[model samples]
Target: MNEDELFEALKATLLKEDREALQRLQDILDQPEKLSQKMSPVLEERLATFKQAFPKEYKGIIEKIISEKLANSKEELLEAIYPIMGKLIKKYTALQFQLLQERIDQKLKFGIWHRIKTGFRSFFFGVKEDEMILNELMSSTIDNIFIIQKHSGLLIASTNNNPAHQDDLLAGMMTAIKSFAEDAFDKNGAELEVITYDNYQLLLESYYSYYFVVAVNGNISSHQSAVIHEKMNNFSAKYLSRDKVKSGQFSQALSINLKSYFFTNPIA
Candidate 1:
């Protein structure tokens, strides 16, 4: 045997196992299903182990990385997290308001004797009874006011602290809801008085001609509801007319009056 043949023999002897392994890997790669079958169990097992150990083993590393990233990219982090933070805050606030309302309801359920005794104590102690009562009640602020035609659901007048789109749509929906509830329940002469969601309450006061829809943010007490009803009645008496509503004539003066009545002062 010459030098070339001897070198070839040596190379083959040294590289035979590696060459076979490479061929096998190439074959597996060419057949994707076979590759997946071979990898599935290994990948799953590794993932399971990683999941089991992750909190203990990688907690510090992950925290460190997050902290570093937050510190370095504060604006980007804020941009990414702001919406989620807002949603969380809104949810938390709503839950808190619900709890507060429940507490108020429980307090208000006290017997007449209890209230009389409390009133006497308040008088003797020189505590402002009105203020004390108000404080105990759920505080609310009026956000939007709408006057819609009773039967037609036409937007008669509206005023909102926040600019809103599609006032007509809201008026129509409110009317639809009122109509549905009245028809479904067949509650004669009993109209929809209030609609509530999350942290907002809508107080509806229906009249002969038109109705008032007051959007209040926060809990509205019985007293507040009565006050709103009185205000709406007065407004209807002063301004709203059946003929005007029927004629589809909405008045800017009515809008101004509503804004003046509700938005001029802080509603409690």
Candidate 2:
């Protein structure tokens, strides 16, 4: 009791407040509910005060530091981004070029460029009703249009009023020549669009039940060819699609349409 009691008295005197605080901390660690109860209000109030004060205290300072960093590193940023941007532009350009090539192929495949050297008057001048024929296209004449039946070589209708051969014979001859060419050339059911001879060229366009044979007298230009194609398409859509034919003929109407045909219209 003498020495040990003396040491205990001195230790307790020196560490009384610290020992009590440590015991409270140990108790808080042991009981989670009590710890939360004690900490919650203080923590929430501090967080609220921090949120209210943080932007006022630090926003301008943080913004200034970031702006200075970005200003100094601008060239570095551009250098890092340029390779990626160039690759993206290159890929986009390649896609656009592929689309352009496909369109050009379609145009060329349909004889769109077929007399390209001739006739640019339509582009330079405005046209109405497609009545004007270019003098450069006078070498060709819209001779006749024949509406002929398939397989039987029968004439449905014709714009040709008088001819060396009868309508039926002319129709039969055309069918025979077409069949011979298909057999020889392995045409594979493609419409024999044009048959060029020394004095004439025949433009053929087949419909569902019948076919059209446009007889041309001389060398046709690209403009003339396109106009003729457009005329046949328009006439067929208007007259041929309907049941206006009495016993399979709209010959007089077809004649009037052919009479209206000229060398040029607006190309588009």
Candidate 3:
């Protein structure tokens, strides 16, 4: 009906499995008699401890409670959703702190390709040598890499003795991208996708809203891509807040805009 409703519907449809799990989680919200007995003493103790440590923190907590209650003043009987939201926030914040406490380098990262620069210029220019290298490097495993965005149209990364036109290869890739975008966005929201070529090659494809497309290749499997997807989801949940200014700042810090720089120096 409304934007929020449509967004929720789209999310549920796209992430049917996840939505199912979330539905199971929602069942816990019902058994309130059990929840009241279970939650009362724990919440009181934590509130007391937090207040003793920092009285100022208690003020925000209380203000959040009041604001939630005021917002739901329409109902004759309002639910205790405020305390639940607050508790969840506190637990999640603590969990994030624990995750951050570990060494930075050892921290797990998404398996997405970190860069999309040409795999090797020589390989593109020298087609036979490049194919040999690709076969050697990727023979043992399936190469699952896909291009997210062509950094500079299709430059001759390497040359082969044959006289195949580079322009044809580039045109085909562009056509594939257009098809991929149609299939991907019609189903999901404005989101990146983890694509596979066969088994050993993985491509991380991202669209810049409605402007440009980007892709990168990597030597990873579909299973590995799933893991990376989970990690990226968590990263997004933890960092991308709803506040406009905060979102903008985080976008600048983490976002990539390659449309301009990528096309500036194209191969003739």
Candidate 4:
């Protein structure tokens, strides 16, 4: 049997034992040690059940808890709760893995990442694809689209659809970021960096001391920002495919950070 089966079996047994333990505790309030005495048998039985159910996976899980070499905090009261908590964690993890497995299977079959990239490309190019992606993303409650590149400036894309800084401001931001990117790439060859911009202003002209602004816009969702990254990655990938020596290091770094956000909140 798989881990899920083992978890379900263990959970059922634990639930029953929990109920019984509570009943016994209610009956023997005067003799609290009676509850402690009864817990050992239940723990042993559950472990035995797990061993029989998933013999291979059981040993590691059991050993980790046993090897912790720490005293149970409630040993004098409800002794089983400590072990039960551990078992519950394992059971919950098993269920989560099962669900994620199913999600991956379905998504992988349909080339979900590829499709997302395609959708993102449309958004960046300001075409039909862009409308679909932007519309869907704006509908969501996500705000603040942050796009960052290590050694480069930050691109703040938003749904405000404002062209306030369409020329000079954008030029200054790009120049500042490009300078940083060139310097870093020249030094490290391949390096990773992360930066954030808490606020900004209308004047495109400013002394960029610590970091520069690459692109600026109004309110945007986390989802739209991710789509932008995905498109940029796809764009870079295609370029790199043609010429292996292309400097896609910045794109790759941004994509890595974007990936963290995507995984945390997909379809958002």
Q: Against the true structure, what is every candidate's RMSD?
A: 20.0, 25.8, 28.6, 25.6
Please tell me which model should have the higher lDDT, number 1 or number 4.
1
For residue 210, give model 1's deviation from the true position in Å: 1.1
Assess each prediction's global lDDT (C-alpha) against the native.
0.74, 0.65, 0.39, 0.43
Write model 1 residue lDDT over 1-268, tens digit each, in one string.
9999999999999999999999999999999999999999999999999999999999999999999988987644543443344344445555665665666557656656667776897889888544455564567778788989888898888995344667788889999999998888886667887888998999887666567899988867665665566566666656655565766556677778878876675544
| Model 3, span 1-268: residue lDDT tens | 9999999999879999987887766765678876677789999999898879785657789888888988775221222232233344445555654443332223213312321122344346654432333333332322111122223222211111233544336434654665567566776443333334544333233312111222334353222333333333333333322232221121323232222222332211
When summed lDDT is taken over every stretch of 10 residues in candidate 4, the lowest stretch is 203-212
Clashing pairs in 4: 122-130, 123-130
Measured against the true structure, the TM-scores of the candidates, in listed sequence, are 0.50, 0.43, 0.23, 0.21
Q: Pick the candidate with the highest lDDT.
A: 1
Lowest-sum lDDT 10-residue window in model 2? 128-137
Q: Please identify which of the two predictions, 1 or 4, would achieve the higher TM-score against the true structure.
A: 1
In candidate 3, what residue range of length 10 has the lowest lDDT sum? 141-150
* C-alpha RMSD of candidate 3: 28.6
The local lDDT score (0 to 100) that residue 205 gets in candidate 1 is 71
* Best prediction by TM-score: 1
lDDT of 1 at 122: 87
lDDT by residue (169-197, candidate 2, tens digit) is 88889988877877788856665668888
lDDT of 4 by residue, 1-268 (tens): 9999999989888799787997877877657687668777998999798878885867788777765644443322222232333344445545664664566456545877756785577767766643444454345332333332222343322222345734334434654655666576787532222233543212121111111122323433433333433433332333222112123123444434444543455543
